[model samples]
Target: MLPSTDALLDGLLDWVRIETHTPDTAGLNSIMDLVQSQAEGFGATCQRFPGRDGKGDHLLVLSPWGDHAQKGVLLLSHLDTVHPRGTIEHDLPIRIEEDRCFGPGICDMKGGAFNGLAAMRAIAESGVTPPLPARILFTSDEEVGSPTSRSLIEDQGKHAKYALVTEPARNGGHVVTARKGVGRFTLKVEGRPSHAGARHWQGRSAVTELAHQIIALEAMTDYDREITVNVGEITGGTGTNVVPQFAQAEIDLRVPTAEAADEMVARITGLTPKTPDTKLTITGGMNRPPFEQSDASKALFDHASTLAAEIGFELVGEKTGGGSDGNFIADRIPTLDGLGPDGDDVHTLNEHIFVSSLKPRMLLLKRLMETLS
Candidate 1:
């Protein structure tokens, strides 16, 4: 049997209390230490990868029941959150109101990560060996696009038969089977600066050129094609009386398929300046490839849905625009995402998970670990 709802909430609170912001190496390592200790206490062998580029360390814990060399089940989770350190003190405090356990990272991911650990611990305690070796990877840089941990995740993917991501369950306890590819880019415009009043004809306005480009970029969005281009941020100009010499805009792109991703990339990169005497420079590309649904993934979800029904809950698959580390390995492995606790208002001041949903989700994960062949 899984832990009681209150017991599960207590464990999750322990994790939510520790703020593991994406870039805070110290705080991240602190949480990693807790995870390592817990996994070690449960007789799981662990390997720690020291973080580089000022990111937090990563932990890989393997179940003691199976051979370490064989391809097995990979449980993917991340410890870092989008909220900063002081978020708990001011923005979202740890509190239980009705059935919701409110905290900074509880809903976004920490709850799901803790549930994965709890399920593993229960299985270990029950003394029933899983059919396949269970490996849980706790990564540190997922919210910032997994920049430091992508290679590590992919390396493990090559050796795994199935990948399960503990990202937050979507819209009322739905699992994710497909995700759009994500792209981030910066566009810069350069032009001659001159006093607006004295030599208006001699100077080119980079801000004006950037504004035109922004309009064109926004116009590229096609809802029917499932492609979106957002000029999220822009900065330019020094003074009102002078023509701007430099301007830059940060863009975000999403595509539902590899073909769409390639087409959008070419379109965005092929931009030219409409303004005379201005230079346009673009940098950056697709950060994550599209996780299109496949036969293997569909079969995996069908198994999960069957298991969920047996466990007395309805399970469905969803395709989200947001991407996760599951996007990294979905094409290569049978991956199921959004296996975390059900919650609402993730990555906001109101972030929280439903206390009632804890035990059922834990049981679902435990069953998946034990029964997946």
Candidate 2:
């Protein structure tokens, strides 16, 4: 049975009501229950692998028509979101204003995930056996860089012939073909502390050293290769009257290719402390390699575009600086992303999905999955 618009929206609302922030193991498991229940209803077998670092277990649902022994299509998505608890009740209370449905994670993910479920449902109801095995992997961590789920994703990518990611469709209905690689880094500086008034010259300020590092890091951004280095967060200092002895900075880096990523990391780590007495420590590296578009990936995109055209819409692929779990899988298999319903303002209280876009997106996904061999 094709899902009615009401049913899809109802499912999206039901899933969105649960706040499965990245670190909330219980919350991620709870949302997985909802997802697994639907998958099971379609005759898919489910397995749960325990997560590390206090995250929820990763859930895998295999269609009865497919098996791990054979290569097939992999549906990739994350169950966790960026919004914390109380977002639904206090911040964006679930509401529909004309064509837009406003709620946390609705656009960023939950909506696209619901499309996955709906597509599988339609295929199962049609009773058409897929030519190859199909698998659905629901990870508990994606927003936090998939630290725990990286290996699992890579393993699955190795077995799958293709990967379809449910990250939100880019604005203007563009699908993602390439994404910049992501890296997380921390910079710390240690210096001698002294009373600001009593011996200002006697103290080397760590904060001052960190400030210089931030400038140097920002200067590393190269638009030519789409390399961007941002010091997203920083902390230091003890009191107004004391020269700070320690300071730290958290950086976010994105590069267009793996070679550029390596070069960028090498340069960042090679930085020298300006103050002679200050000691600097740097940690963390690339999280996901860039999703470079290859001929195989382009072929997959072309197929999806053809399928999209059948649904009466022209699909165009674009490169994005934002990274997804697709960044991990794309390098391994033919991956096509941004297969979710169109939406905007993700990671914010105003996040929402276009209510009108849900049905067509689901249909498109259903067709693509059905066409997979």
lDDT winner: 1
TM-score of each: 0.99, 0.97
Ten-residue stretch with the least lDDT total in model 1: 61-70
RMSD of each: 0.8, 1.2
Best by TM-score: 1
Q: Give the TM-score of candidate 1.
A: 0.99
Model 1, residue 2: what's the lDDT? 59
Off by over 4 Å in 2: none
Taken over the whole model, the C-alpha lDDT of each candidate is 0.93, 0.89
The TM-score, computed over Cα atoms with residue i paired to residue i, of candidate 2 is 0.97
Candidate 2 lDDT over 1-373, as tens digits, reads 7888888999889998888989888888888888888889878889888888898889988877755699988989887989888878888899999998999889889888888877877787789877877888889988888889989999988889999999999986789999999989999999999999999999999999999999999999988868999999999999989999999999999999999999999998888999879999999899888999989999999999999899888898999999999998787698899999999999988999988888888988888778877
